[model samples]
Target: MQLGGDETRRLADFLAASGSGSVPSDTGGYIVMPTKGSPADVIRALQDLTATDRMDALAMLLREASEKPAILGDLVSRLAADERFIEKAAAAMNLAVYRQVLFRLETMIDDPTVKEGQFQALLEEQPWLFGSEYSCILDRRRWTRDEITDFVPRRTTDGRVELIEIKTPLHGKSLFNWDASHKVWAPGVELSRVVAQAENYLEKLDRNRDGILANDREDVTKMRARIIIGRDRDDDQRDALRRHNGHLHRIEIITFDGLLAIAKRVLRYFEDAPAEQCVVLGT
Candidate 1:
């Protein structure tokens, strides 16, 4: 069946809304065209629609295709045939997945008893949250035969090699405690301890830099360290982090909430553009 003007418009609205992480009111109302014969036939038709670059039609197609596993498989196969369509579809899918992850992270960050391993898992799964320009090269990666750091990392694009240490959000009080007597914020005990740990990791890497590069095939001479822990207590805490981070030339510290914010920003980058259409149209 050919998509009518109203259907096309609705699909556009849906695509726009989904890109922004909002569910359109009429998502469930869109109709999926029935397959003519085999799943391949349906995909061929969808490929035709994607040529138009109408993101709405593609959104509708994906929604409908999701209900038919066989057809979905066909759709996946066809993704390779069109670079533009595949890129758009991939971005849309990534944004959706990361948004769900962000929601779960919000809950996890609030739980004071959450373990450092859990946070490490999240970062490993979604490396973009760490930084737009960072990717996970190693997790619980061994520096020596017996010495493992929480993460051995790489630049997402191109930059200095880095080391990362994560601590449980529950391990710290506020990242910074209000020192009312001096009317200034000071790094909390947990934050200080983690920072020290990161520093130690950096030193270890430096001492074994040549060995690590030979083993991992990654340069570590300019490696820096980052410690992720706790949550910001207030604006004062954030200001404290800025001041504290400024002095530390080699190691940077960030709170759990700060990490979450970075993740959300990454999601926004993908959602800013309307995805290209991928709906299959009639014969």
Candidate 2:
């Protein structure tokens, strides 16, 4: 969701105030005081919080209000009175909606009837799957010549890149085929193909880093690859899948179920964390 000018200013102000020596008081008011650092430093710290952290803070607040009936009214009143809090709350609501959409989209990942075009589109829409620190750098308007490498998402912290490849989540056929004779589920054809493709994409990016940087201005020095395909059928398959992924060095493999697990962990962070800890305000 896009923030308007006013909303952006308010969020900045809130972040600044939070970074200032603002402490939560017993009366539920912030005790704002002088901070040691420069105003610019404080602002930078506020800006350092990733998009995921902001959304998680809001989710935490929502979960807290739900669990504690007594504090619900107080929380709502505070949110209504504080414009910054309301702005954050709105963002949190948007994230929740998006999370639900991602859940629904997972069904199509495994559906054989859904074309690759549709599956790719669905994957493009959900940037959160890459975690909170990464954002999509390529869209339809600026996709690379290579079709195997679906998109490149950059890590916000270090400008490092991840080459992502997508494949349909196949049913019955696991990521690795079960070998009853050998007592192991070996990497299946689809999994091996995608892994090789991702590795190739990584090598290509490393080789053409200068040219890519000239064109897109993204860092590809510290690069890795991710392959999204298939599903874990059962406990045995899941165990074997973990062992298989362990051997891979450059490329990490994940199933649709594994992707959802990552999302769930992120959502759970908000649900479990204390509000104060979730949104830090220096004192």
Candidate 3:
């Protein structure tokens, strides 16, 4: 096989001054090379192009892209051959999309007006913002006769529906109270009310679970729930929330801040992922 490439102006100048045909000890602005190069070498060959060569490369590449669009279908076929391949590809795509999401999330974290309704709307549009624990948002939002949950995202494990009840993050109000006497944390009235509200929603879902399954094919097994309210303002508050949540059995609580942190972790996972695992298509 033969390798082909275009050179960058800087690299071309270096090569000219160096008077070397072979790129010393590394990759080059592609002027083409012998075949049997590593995968990275091949990719660099395609990417490292002079301004003059870029237009021609772009046209040829566009033609190649347009000519064999079935290459993506070929990738899907390859994924079907290996489940691990599919998972890696999916993860790569999700991480690529998360950059846009993180921007909005970071912006909202400090914005006062991005409240419950705003958060709900964002989550509705981008449910993956909730992380991979939840499979997908259920089509059936009305869990019971009078109960309408913010979201009924199904758990990834068994497809059982998990209720997500999000209230406005603590702004001027308090969600936790510091108990000076006992040296412990206590739930503020708002937090207590939000927890109870989530419990009620769970209870209603449990009572109406069979009916819901029959009607909508949605599973609400045992009715576990997540209450997303308040903010972990500082290390103490964050630790306090963690301790408070540890005692609970069925319902789990996370502040908006915690939720954002989860997304950042996900972003970092992709950043650190192996290059081989990151590629879903192309040689």
Candidate 4:
């Protein structure tokens, strides 16, 4: 299908998320075209498109994007996550104008792909990544409101409180080249999955705060929600966090890079913490 500007952006986003997996043959499936240019080049070309313009420019952009295979997956993912794409989708009308775009954009909204056990798996892999000194006590079987309180949260050194929830990122419906070699990752899913999981966990926490919080004045420490993605994310995720500063519930999104950073920091912090502050497995 010939994609309009918005559709083009959506396609780009999907392609970015495909991450070395195979690109789907059908439009309904995820499509990540290869790209060789710098991300800046891709975005610039996208920003300049109009309804009247032929898709020649868009095609060239995609063709060029296929070159830098290493970064293309991540670059396209970031492009799709760009706020401008969201705004454009809100303004779009024609499906041809943005059907592909709308579908990709909608993927971020209520990602149901997050399986029940996935959260628990993420937590098991990286306990300290969420700033949770205690190991996770997840009840993966149910999304019960009552289950929220059974899990214990940790307090940060800065005196903020946070509830750590780990997550896994879902890719577009297709496989990328990396999938052929078994190296799989998707940047858009990397960001959206974390953001979505954090939001869900926060809602639960807020709903059951009375059960979890001892008292209001006790200070809600950091109230954290961490997401552990299988892939890398981009600056757009950081931008999302920056825009939602005050309302962020002290939640933090951690990519593989963030994981490494935390590993180093946690070691130092643990050294200063009192022996009693150490996490006891069941607590």
Candidate 5:
């Protein structure tokens, strides 16, 4: 891979460090070279580099470990013995991956081909982005086949189920619009449709709550739903969403931008976490 300026400096530093202990010029036809060094020095060197470089090095190491299963197993066994290290490492990876997800979403938000399926898949894979209160997404049931709606249900940490509906901002309709007749912003046709569909899902699920409780072993009592869709064109529309959403009981609407803001806050918590050694690469 082509090295950037920062990476070039890192390479230079590495070369200078290993430049010592050269082979003799007249020591037979060939000589063995030293390929190992101090693990502490390696850790220090990695720490001196940027986080990106450290992650790249980690990716390489993981790939190498995958090829050598014994070492990988032993390494995991040792690392898993420390609960604190696991917590710190998990936090770091979560922050890194969330940043990446935010970047991907921001870059692809306007792409025409990327639709509900893409966003649904992304949110499902990273349910923590919704918040730590959520534990895991529930499996889609066959009952929703009749409605053909994309309702993502997640179990809360306390075992209550939450229905989440996601839509691409490419919905081609404003979520909140000025009601020229009423002289205030109100939910547009499309947004109202999604909310109604979510309520419908909730109603159906409520009716089948007992079935879900017995069969799926999930609690659906006093369930709440969140609708993720649309975009705010300006401050007025955003404020309007807040006003309208406040009127709803258990259902809420959140634009993608709002979701992004929420994700940023989650990231900030990690950014504020106590510094720890890089568990993956030994920073």
Candidate 6:
């Protein structure tokens, strides 16, 4: 589960050299390449890979290695634990591949003969459900003025001055225009319906205010509402969430497909992020 500094450096070097812009040549047990960059550069380079690119590269790498059965286990194990390699490997490995890997790793962990650290290592390599840094103000029946300021935020980080609202229909419906009278979208789910949820969250944050978004200088006062109608749901959801669109408000009313796509991204982040940063709110 843990790599020594030297090994980490070497692994980082391997990842950076194997990246898209560099050439990688297998040199016996360890890969060899010529580059003036440090190991940190390689780690950063690996992180720079787009999720799509990493997934593609990992598939090709695994497929090619599958032809050589002798080194398959070592290759796969190294790829799984290497920080520089994991994101790409997770992306590259298909759902079936991931399932198989998790099953085998779980079996290893369940064995009483294995050490606790070994079990932890297996967990580090595999994870369950994935999701984004979800943030919401839960509405409760009881509250006080003093208790309001002491409320814990739902997001991963603080000082978030924007709320992004997304509106999408259940199916692939089009939003040609907004029905001003009903305050809903035409032929699809209305922007107001989705914004209503955001508004509720805002209201929970500031119960006594007349409007959800108050013109405050300190706390978050502005929100940029987005309506993703007829948009490609799956992978597009993650992209839509990440690209905040130059505005502050960044919430999404995504279809199940879109939610699934971003769910993976959130999972990937959960797997790779630091322990302290991974604190669960309700837990």
Candidate with top TM-score is: 1
Q: Give the runs in model 2 whose Cα sits over 4 Å from its true position.
A: 1-85, 88-92, 109-112, 135-148, 206-221, 271-283
lDDT of 5: 0.66
TM-score, candidate number 5: 0.62
Model 5 misplacement above 4 A: 1-59, 62-94, 140-157, 217-221, 275-283
Q: What tens digits encode model 2's per-residue C-alpha lDDT throughout 1-283?
A: 9999988987788787567845343466332323336768657645754556465665677688778878877776775455356345645555565567567666676577876567667657766555666744554323345644676777778777677777777766777777889987788888888887777666776778788789877656667788878888689778887887889887888887887777677656654655544343110
Candidate 3 regions with alpha-carbon error over 4 angstroms: 1-97, 216-221, 274-283
Candidate models: Cα lDDT each: 0.69, 0.67, 0.69, 0.45, 0.66, 0.44
Q: How far out, in Å, is residue 23 in model 3?
A: 43
What TM-scores do the predictions have?
A: 0.64, 0.59, 0.61, 0.32, 0.62, 0.28
lDDT of 6 at 44: 72
Q: Backbone clashes in each candidate structure, one number apiece?
A: 5, 0, 3, 27, 0, 11
- Give Cα distance to truth, residue 162, candidate 5, Å: 0.6
| Ranking of predictions according to TM-score | 1, 5, 3, 2, 4, 6
Model 2 TM-score, 2 decimals: 0.59
What lDDT, from 0 to 1, does candidate 4 have? Answer: 0.45
Q: Tell me the alpha-carbon RMSD of every candidate.
A: 12.3, 12.4, 13.2, 24.7, 11.9, 16.7
What is the model-wide C-alpha lDDT for candidate 2?
Answer: 0.67
Can you rank all candidates by lDDT, best first?
1, 3, 2, 5, 4, 6
lDDT (10s digit) by residue, model 3, range 1-283: 5334544655565677468653465655322323336668656644643333233434444455456876645554553355344345444555555678788977886787887888888888877678767767778777688988888887889777777887877787666788999988888998898788877777777788789889977666566779888788878777878887898767999888888888777567656877444332111
* Candidate closer to the true structure by TM-score (higher is better), 1 or 2: 1
Q: List ranges where model 4 is wrong by over 4 Å.
A: 1-152, 156-160, 169-190, 211-222, 233-249, 265-283
